[model samples]
Target: MKKSLLLLIAFSLMVMGTQVQAAGQDIRLVVDISGSMNRTDPNNLRIPTANMLADLLPDGSEAGVWTFAREVNMLVKHGLVNDAWRDQVQEEAEKINSVGLYTHIDHAIETVTWDADWDVDKDRHLILLSDGLVDLSQADTQEERSRENQASRDHLLRERLPQLVDAGYTLHTLALSDEADQDLMATLAQRSGGLHAIAYEADDLMPLLLQILNRVVDSEQVPLEGNEFSIDPLINEFTALVFHQPDAEMVLHSPSGESYTRESDQSNLNWHGNARYTLVTVKEPEAGDWQIETPAHPDNRITVVSDLKLHTSSFPATVYRGFPDKEQTLKAWFTEEGQRIDRREFLRLLDAQMQHHQDDLLLTEKNMPFAEDNLDFRASLTDFDELGEQQVTVLVDGHTFQRQVTHSFNVQDVVAANLQLPENGGTPKIVLRAQHPQLDPDQVDFQVTANGEAQPIDYRGDGEWQVDLANLEPGREYLLEVEAEGKLKGERLNLVLPSMRLEEGSVRALDRQPEEPQETEESQQTPPDFVPNIAPQVIPSPVLPTPSASQTEEASEEEQQPAQSEEESDPPVDDETADEEGLFEMDFSPIKSWDDPRMLWVYVALGLANILLFTLAFILYRRFIRRRKERHDAQVHDDEDTPEIDDLEFDLDDELDPGK
Candidate 1:
């Protein structure tokens, strides 16, 4: 307590009127989290020298974190050492998403080099705890674990390992397994200015931890000549460093009543906010690896979260729902599991699935029973989730099929069609066209029928096919079949319909909802005899007057914004005019879009969703592949030397600050 009091007094004195000196070491730890490390190291070590080595670091020493598997992951920032808050750090570390793919130590080294925004002359060390078994099997040119083809892993490590040392990162390898290369560990140590050690078992880890601690604490002369600062407790959020720079002042523009100003000092060049972060920031520096981190949004590692709220934007795609209202909700649904939506979040997903299908000349006139209020002509559509084992499928217009399939969500198909129907249409002169770059146009075949009888079609297309019809019925149904043998197939029935719109206030808004079920007739409503709504001009909200810190209490969401939208909730509008219904009074709030890292959750949630999806897909794919290999007489190389895949970084845009 006395030591702490003295330290505080000294710190205060420095802040008040001393030489205002700045000097401290900003150390970062780059850990290796691979499958091999989990295996019992030599001497029955649980996690080799990791935990033991951790115990030796100077308490409250400046540090950042990075984890490596197939890729590299930064866990914390280069700041002060924290022993008391380690439990949370350890928990987060344990949860690091990793898959045993193939670890590229060289790649990890390259990654740190790319993110090197701090002083290379300072005490920068890479405390690499690994089995020392190099993975030279797969290539990481494209993300994910590729097939293991490189057999010269040992030789590569021998010839290529020294480059990382030249990059000024001290490599302290904790050899955990007998299969690990001690020579390489020593070489890494010598090259990177790191010490090589042997941590065989769980108990053996302590010495290594202490060794690192001694190196950091004893060297003692590492001086960080910069300013010191601290953001308010709640508003400030950031435990680790994603990126940063020196001489940066992160102004925390108080939200309503919580204003904070932090001036840089000699010892503290960056601000560290953890626990329950409630702060926002105004960052001045634009370059470096140790950027400002908000406590409220550590995973996001940015100020935008504090600005935006539960926000995310997705590519445009026509979402199908069992209910009409749900289809036009603009709500993002999980493609694999539509029902799994986080109600607390505000999603901004795109509706981008139309362009792909619209361009291929696949969309033909499909007649809806009620075309009076609809203006949509679709060519082809297929549901992959329910399409059984075959990954690919085609959209058809009866006999003429234009094959279109997207196994990944990244690709959206748009099919377009332009054909004229003659009044005497037996098979009115039909012309089929295919215009997709990814598609084989020759595989497309055409079958047309105007009134019950089907007729063969001729190719009049550079990309189009033609068919001659004898007689046609005006309001009678006509079928257009597009069949592509081994390529694609689907039917496009003609439907002349008017454009449709959604009703105003048709459904209650909730934070989250399940996928819509089948809509009943009674659920359908007559379009309200409302006047056509004039599109309101959106004026950005103005910068709000900041609340002084002295203001103890503040307003709620309702008090701040007009609650008239809910107060005047009228009867649900019909689906036909839902799009045109007036909801909120269309005046824009004019406020400066200053950032709040806390709001980064919106974007973080969005990015996490994307990553989780990819990870899930990869896992399922691996499982199916393994099952197939089990049955086939194939060489399944399940080598023990496979490394791990590092999770992608989290970014924020919408979820953080809406203004941002």
Candidate 2:
């Protein structure tokens, strides 16, 4: 029993080790297809570089390809790396044409970061290639447009990049040209715990890509143990020193002789570890030799973390790509060193030319609201129908932040085939319309099958084809299978029409009909009379008396007297006779008061008061005007009489006297 137990334990350990080794890494290659890439890389070596990288990747690894120009496109989705997949990827890479108009780095990164299938338990990496900074130029002048474009790209990078880093995804960047934003690329790589490389020409790209891939795939830890050892780091490069034994006391001396013990609080050093191991990360290490000393344990091991270091896992990766007409949302939460920063101003959208095009501005609904919380600022984009590149700019604390994006307006081919029935109850037919750019009308052929039997179709000119369904039964569902072939190779299309019900009264239409109300036997039966179960009305105890005939007659008489008096007091005037006598003139009798028999006197007094006020205003206005004129004349007279400061006295008199 003891021997059997030992064998079982050993088997279990072997299985666990196999499982750990089987966990694979996910790597995505993101390439730039912008117009600038075509200019910078005249040899068009990106495709070959990508193919070479694919060849170098280890078998059974997960890898994918994504490209960005004015927009992002996933040529090969993430899948297991095998011989077939590598060949397929190579073919797709060969098809990549440098026809895109803009460099949308943010969109490309976001696409891989968000859209790709990322396995968190396994290692994840994003290899980015770009020839230049994000270009969103819509400006007339190159200088202004470039400035705006950089600002927009910077804003987007700052806002969306931290999410990738925070998610634990390492980003490796390859700068493809001299104009590439080296600082930004390096910053992105460092923040994401990755590496950045620069390629001055097309020749340097493939080798660099291969080197990075090899480092990631074949990374091995080098053990170090000694009293004194030298460590050198590249200038402005991130370096890390890891001690395997947590209890080991170590002292590190910088090139400047600055000594740092394990407990030293150095600004550039970020320390984190446990009992098993301790790690120290130095940002932008000094470009000189450094020394380490550990007196505690002879068994202590030191590991160097440099550009060749590989990460096992990274942050969730995603990328966004779509047509220009669709709305895109960009979100970012502002924070500094884990503290929220609420100093953002506003976010704006620019066209491909990097100009302030009002038509391309983000929709009001997509605007990011300024708030003090840690919630993300979101902007909705719309009306970016201009083909090629666009940009989103966010203003943070008076600094311009920007991101370049691309879009396409290409519409895919659509096959519109539907069943139509005659309104007069004749043969049902299938109507077909092919909406494809490359479809040749003469070469287009279609076959229809219903209920596992072939159906006859009549070809009509002008790209219209139809199939008769007279043999099919009416008011019954039938399955339809349609096969269509276009002129281009591999342009075949197959469509299975939904089960459709035929009608005897008319031909069945493709559009769905509303369900008619059903009449059941119970509903058809007559409804019983709705008898009232209400209680009887109650009678009042005291009833009011009805008016007598005399009282009613008196009320009628009183109402008639007013009408009679009004008629008797008023005189009847004929309108025609009154017009001749000028009796239609305006009347002032209504304004005549009871105390004053005539209102004419009041009107006369008002008219006099108005005249007096107007006379006074006019006199004052004239006097004011005269005084202003006199002041203007006086100033003019003074200006004319004033002598010039440069005039010299007696110079002309002296010259004239001498000449005479």
Candidate 3:
């Protein structure tokens, strides 16, 4: 009874754990058919893109499609996916066109999510594609129309976005052209922890959609190198999406040297040839090497359905330059079903690498090594100097199979300032420039502090500030902190600048070194490395302080000290080290705890649930087992109460002696 009860309780806990992680992923497509799309998407590439995404969506996952113009219409009803659902979506995709007079994005989103059951066991996602700003046809006058559109946008941002965030709905947005509302799309994605991409041309839609799918689904991949990949025994089915020239044909070669094409009479193959791309799926594929003969394209990929999969940490969509608490770290591991794979023999055979890309250029590559326990792989991304869209593709290579996943993020500077500290004991001046074009420089104000006391700043023309050090003592080290406040795109930006060390009439930024050997005259001509500034504007804050006398003494005592390079000399301390050294702090807050009434109620409800479950389990065991025991005891007692045959012997003697 105890063992059974233990098993039942274990099963209940497992179910709760699975719910916490969520289950399969669900995606909803919301497309714009605004009249402007007639010029942006002249080829009607969205039809095929939608069809392809439907094909790629695995079975048992939930998906739906909706298109909006003046009216919101459902192309595919949201439900669990199957062969029928995919076919319906393909049939319905043909109806998508840029004939509508207006774009009713607000109405479309509301209708799609009006009856959404958020309690479903799935990770919800919404892919919103647009080629124009929000427009509605309900107003008679042009001014009324503009007013209504702005109101609708405000409602979507202020009300709808917060609800979606609370309900765990990630919104991946795509801007189909320059005329599209890119800022709104970016805001929605960023606020919801989703992805946003710009399709410079209509033809770019398919590849961007594929990249988004790479993040949406949990599918393992077989890495393709030079158009070749290997399949393993564990693979049940594999699909390859290959991009080729408009007139070029793609050929697939199996390990046995057998070549197949779209014309091949293979019962286990499904081939789809579309404009600029071809998708092929092979079932029960042979477990060996396979190659595709086609023009090389970076977006070409192969995804497989298997029990063994590669899972990775969700990289941030945006990386802030000066936030130490928001540092980016990437991790990957193998999993079978829902559990992590820890067997060393299997892990030792695999190698992992991350490829960093900026547009058509490959910025760098990083090798991900297994942890000391040899259970997973991890890599810290420190080389983010490139300030633009960065796509990181992680590839795990093995003898028979491989896995790959791509993530993209943008690097943005919060503030751009250069501290011109004199080496010859002169005046300390700051040349502060706005990195973001939207920042209003004239309105920016600074709060300067020297040794925890406020200092007066003399603002000079053209983004220059002169710090008066006449009253300050010479040769005494001073810790200087600068805070900038400004109007950025009509919003207040608070920026925290890196601290500076001023001593002996010289000043240097503590987060950086006093001298840079690799900094060339030409490189210095460009903007300085951005420092965090806040107060209704952007800039990264510093966590490191100037080296103390004790640290300098320890550095001198070390006999075999390595040479300090420009980057290594005095880098800003990470959050972990900052906590250990107790130098600075990063602010974080929890929404729920003992202090919140809602949290207290939630905890009380959970405690009551646990008690109820325990009581129910105890009653079930006792009721059944105790009843069975009682029945057995009653039978034994009845047998004892009845006279035995040995006792009847005396009666037999009495009967023989004639009724004594």
Candidate 4:
């Protein structure tokens, strides 16, 4: 009876779990076909890239492709990935041509997302590729056209982007040329937690798109080193991408030294060769090392479709030098499909290490310690002491198989927010001094909380914000978050301040009770007037160590200042708007249907042809009517000149005389 009851409970739990939808990736691809693409991508490399993407998509994932310019078109209708869907995509890719007049980016996005459904269990991703700024054809002045374009961009960012974020969409954007709007593309990626890349030339599009795809989708890949990659027994299938020159020969060598080429007739191997790249998919690939005999290319890759794979956590794009809390902690483990592999015997032979590098210099290499449960390995990333772009690769080397993943991040200066606990009993203030001169003081926002409840903040001039902590029960902690916009060089930047923690009575200098009158006034602060300000000061940071009361007092005195009145603290709304005007760069040179000299001449020629056609038609109609009237008059005159019945009597008499 006990065994039967256990089985019954397990079945009930499984049934309950089935009520939730399974997690799957739904990807939408949006491409631009504007007229500018004629110069940007004259060879139409996007077609081959799209085909490769369709073939490489996983079996259970759903995807669709769209092409847009003045109008949005569904090139490949959204559907589940299957052989039929892929064939249809291949057929439809040929229809993409560079004949569109305008680039209506907002309309394309709206059309793609208007009727789409969202599910909590699925991750929806939109990959947008473009090569030019937002241009809409209109008959207006250059400045007016620019304003309209800005308005369209603003609407897309302010309204549609938030909806996508709320619906859990990762929007990866690609800017294809120097003329493309890099800021907007970067902002979309940052806001949506997606990857963004810029392609300086058309040739770079394929490699960059592949990079974005690999990041967005957690597909397992075997590391290709020196044009060779090893495949283990657990891998059911694998796809290899090889790039080559036009005149060079490409070949694939199998584990048993069997050579395969484009002409090889094998039921298990599907070879797709192109002018620039060859994509090969193998079913039930043989175990052992395989080699692609082609010229060395950086973009050569191999991804696998398998049940057993290595799963790892994603790393941040940026980390601070002195902030330990913001440090990336890598947690990785092996899995059979989606279930965790927890067998000790299986995990014992596996080794995982993270190799860090800056440019060509090797910084450090460390191993991830296994957990007690033998399920996952973790290690704190502590090698970010230097500034600049850094690359880290996680390599998992097992007895028979190997897997690796690499990503890059930037190390920046420590941006701190310090909470000044008053030496004498009063309201605690948070001070953040401006570290960069271009930091905008007016464009700031704060998300502050006290003991899990929303706490109001009063913005005082000079980078100080006052918060009330009088009602704290002496042991609870609070959280504060600050976000601001600033400028770097000549370009605008979105600055995300680190979240700071404040514990009650932890850093107080003395055991003093709060003053009653000041406490009452601080508690009564309103929410609307709690604006934020930016300045150069240190706030609480993970690198901060607990200091004595005197140390805290000294830091507070150096940073703190007298609070300003509400009128003086609030920024002028007009000046803020003026400063932000012309954020979107619009090119008026492309708007030239009526402005182009050649088009003007074409219009004049068409107008003259219409006038000549009308005159010829009128002349022909008048001649036809005149001819008909002349024929009628000739028949009437003949009837009038001839004799009638009165002359019949004379005719009869003449006939009788002729008979006699």
Candidate 5:
């Protein structure tokens, strides 16, 4: 009875877990198709950076592409990610690289985020390749400029960028020019925890890609069985991780038994659906063949299919069990056909379990279907659709906060609210029923409340759902009561709670509101008016000595008197909107913003200096290279005319004279 009770309790918690579609660290590489990445990335040999990325990805490491010239374009037709997706990516990338279009970095980012159906959980990897400054020529006035700046900032921040932040896919910004957005790149890296690389030319690409791609998923492997009947690891898309060499060549076999090795002879191979067999060739031959020969082991052999992975590539049937697990070790790598599968010794399950335990990103390899029978599933919130209506934005400390959604459903179906009592327990039984316009209020299913109050919220038009909180105290207990068609469906939707957070703007506004008391009538009264003579006073001249406190006070009063008289003589201008025009930048309200033409000259002067410096460097480099080439050529010609010298040659007096 105790064992059965414990099993029931263990099963309960698993049912209670929420099925939220959390973010993943899937990466999308936005390559610069500006006809430049095609010109060999000098860092990664002659291979283009695009191709390098394609090669570097591990099997099942999901990747997407966004190529940009003047406009941003997605490589795939939709969201299909497989080996065949490469052709589309390569084609678009090639077009982008070779085409000549004005580079607009801001536009590219905006297009991808707005048009390409950005995945919140996946890391956004954007590569901008234009070699120029961000053109904000559209902003001509102060107002326009402010709006432009706001648009630029909002273009990236318009959506709550949680998916990017949590996934740690900061932009791995690779720039071909020194003029790339270094600050923006740094911001993206800092926010998303990605890398930033600057390649001034194509030659500096291969090394960069190689450096990043060195980390293969599950690079370490060990044998489970002996040198004969062995087991090893091989990762593919879905179906073919077989027992072979620790790093074996994956090949496809036809039903007739014809085999073809993987095009890329790498251990971490990308999986395709065409593979039919896992062929493990042996280093040493003739040992296992003789043992299983003829009638000795016709029925003793067993066939098992094993396609284990350390990544998220979804191919069919490669993940689940096919063979008897690797725990039962044998002397050699043997196939179920009784054929000696060679080149490996062993395969173990302990290591596979270890890998599984370590992989926190992917919970499990199998896309296990949800079973409502054995598990507890709930929908606290449902039918989340945003319409263009009264969208009330809440602010906290001057910062915009997430909008809270209140939803109400008609009780067409009755469900049981299996709410558990808190530690300092209160009520034992609770039930909730819902009624909508289409359903009868009398025949409602369940009632949900923030507190223990019987008064439930009602649904209003335009998606307005109301719930009474009279019983709710700040940070207190509540229960979601449910009852469906007189019989409760399940306690799946009861554990709902509110997520309340203060906006930064609200906090700031609270801080900025004045806390001082208003001025009183007596305090508001001005200082007594002092009448003073404007004309220079003619008085008795006296010998000046260091003045005493009273004398100094009188002198200061006399000095201030003239300033007061001048202020009274010329009353201050009351116009608050006017400023004395000066020789500097000026914005004429809604119309014009003009910087003194002298500022243009300042830039011209800077440009001239840059030109001079560039010319000087170019000339110096040419001279040095030219002189070095001349010396090399002269040396080569002189070497051709000279006789060869060897260490074995004797330096006789006769030989020395001839050289002289």
Candidate 6:
């Protein structure tokens, strides 16, 4: 049972670890689709480059493609890198034929950095491929618009790129042409701890992209010592290099039995430092293993660089300043050929250097048995007391196999600034507090503005500033801008604090009011029934007089009686004319009382119905009482007839004898 429980726990942990590693990668490919690409590229290399990138990316990695000219359009939303996604991305990429007129590089960067769907805990990368010719002109004029656009692009690079870096997104830049902005690209890459590479022509783009993808996916290194070394590249366009022997003769054989020696085909082979190292470039290499033969120096190592990946436990942004004697550990590792090399002597042979402020700091390898798959090394820094803009560099030894990585940390005495606003209405008072020991109270300057207009600021003692907002209008927004200038570690510091807005009330009103419904002429007109003057008065018809029973009987009997003489009938004609005259005149009189015998009979019937209802109700109540009494009597009888079981006794001895 214990073993089974342990196995179950281990399985759960393994599944969890797989889930953590398989959180997948998010990569945004921001491509330039301006009209200039048509003239500069001519061959339409961007589409093919995107295709190569999609093919090279690891399966299940989510990627999004964005193209920016006048505006940015998403070709492929972030999705898993399946075969269908690859095909879809390739199709959309083909549609980008450089038709747009303007290049909005700033807009593209802002959209990808802020608007793109990013998984915060997962590995996120932004691969920007542009000519860096940012043209944001949308007006009729040219020169003035160009200047504004250039300034906007410069501001984006200076401000937004740092924010992206601080948010922990690595941005890799690829400059496609000689006219591309190299300085901006390098700055972006360096600040974000990403690699920056240049492509002089269209052909160099694919390899540069492949290198980036490899860094994101996996990296490995294989040491070669024998006369014959073979390497199997599963993917096409694999880069291989053999280093540390200048005079060694080398021969390479393709899988198709084509041989390439130092003297035969030297086009693909590039030598560094007088044939000290050779870099072999294989374009669309075969699937089978390729052999490399070196005659001299069998012990000399040939390091096969597959992918270059740097993993650190604590990044530069995470490092904090401590006391002068306080010791802090910096752990880092590098992966090559998908394997972790934690050997101390092997790491020492690489000659890794860690420097801070032009001083080389010594780093010792730290063994981490719990992390078997990660190569862990630690460096101790004792003098972190000097604060403000500290940087460290880590690099390997050889030129061909060397990796130069630098990370910067801002060591400040004050980590954050605290600002307190007044609660009541009056001249607004703001209290500025510094959280660090070295921060001076007098160096901070606070300026308040109401609706873009500056207000008078009165500086009180001990980091407090009072702004006279007495003349300022209420129910309006006021902005507070704070500037803190101080000196730390012999470096001048000018910091612009976060802008804060204050309104008269806790919640500010919306800028615009909701539109109200309009009243039409037809709606305003009231109906004739609703208006007293125009209302039609309805006159009711007169009620007909009911005939007496005797009169009705006399009329029926007269019809059955024998007819009188013509003279007797003629006497009734005058009476009939009088009846006709009476019928033409209607009696207009109010009904006073109902004194007819039929009305008396109706009142008598209603009284009889009320008495009948009362008698029926009385009968039902009597029946209910009688039934309830009978049920009570029956219950009493049942209780009396039921005998108690406790009173009855059994003869156990007699019963036992009868069974035997």
Stretches off by above 4 angstroms in model 5 are 1-25, 33-47, 58-62, 115-132, 136-169, 210-660
Give residue 264's error in model 1 in angstroms. 39
Best by TM-score: 3
On residues 1-660, what C-alpha lDDT tens digit does candidate 2 reach at each position? 999999999999998865664477778999887655555677777877777667556677789999887578998878889878887886798777666765667777877888334436666789889865565544443345445665666555567766776666778878886445544565466556565666766766765664455435643222232434334441233333333343665567778898876688888876643333344556666645566654433223233334322111111111112222235454444333445544444222221111112123542323355333534444555543332112233322212222221211211123445554311122345666543323466766677887677888786533456776656643445666677654443444443333443433322334344222122211111111111111111111010011001111112322211111111212345887866654454434333133443455678999999999999999998996576455544555665665433333433533454432
Every model's TM-score:
0.27, 0.31, 0.60, 0.59, 0.30, 0.39
Candidate 6, residues 247-285, lDDT tens digits: the string is 565667777788875567555453221233344555555
Name the candidate that leads on lDDT: 3
Q: 239 in model 4: Cα distance from truth in Å?
A: 1.8
lDDT of 6 at 78: 74
Clashes of each: 154, 35, 22, 9, 74, 9
lDDT of residue 209 for candidate 1: 46
lDDT of candidates 1 onward, in order: 0.35, 0.50, 0.68, 0.65, 0.32, 0.51
Q: Give the candidates in order of TM-score, highest first.
A: 3, 4, 6, 2, 5, 1
Give the C-alpha miss distance for residue 486 in model 5, angstroms: 64
When sorted by lDDT, best at the front, the candidate numbers are 3, 4, 6, 2, 1, 5
lDDT of 3 by residue, 407-505 (tens): 867665555445543211223444444434334567778888879888777764333355554455444567878888866656666778777765442
Instruction: Give residue 268's error in model 6 in angstroms.
Output: 27
Indicate the TM-score of model 2.
0.31
Badly placed stretches (over 4 Å) of model 3 are: 1-22, 116-118, 137-142, 336-339, 412-660
Which residue pairs of candidate 6 clash?
219-336, 219-337, 219-338, 220-336, 220-337, 220-338, 221-336, 221-337, 388-411
In the range 499-564, model 5's lDDT, one tens digit per residue, is 111121110111122122122111111112221211112110010000001111112322221112
Flag the better candidate by TM-score, 1 or 6: 6
lDDT for model 6:
0.51
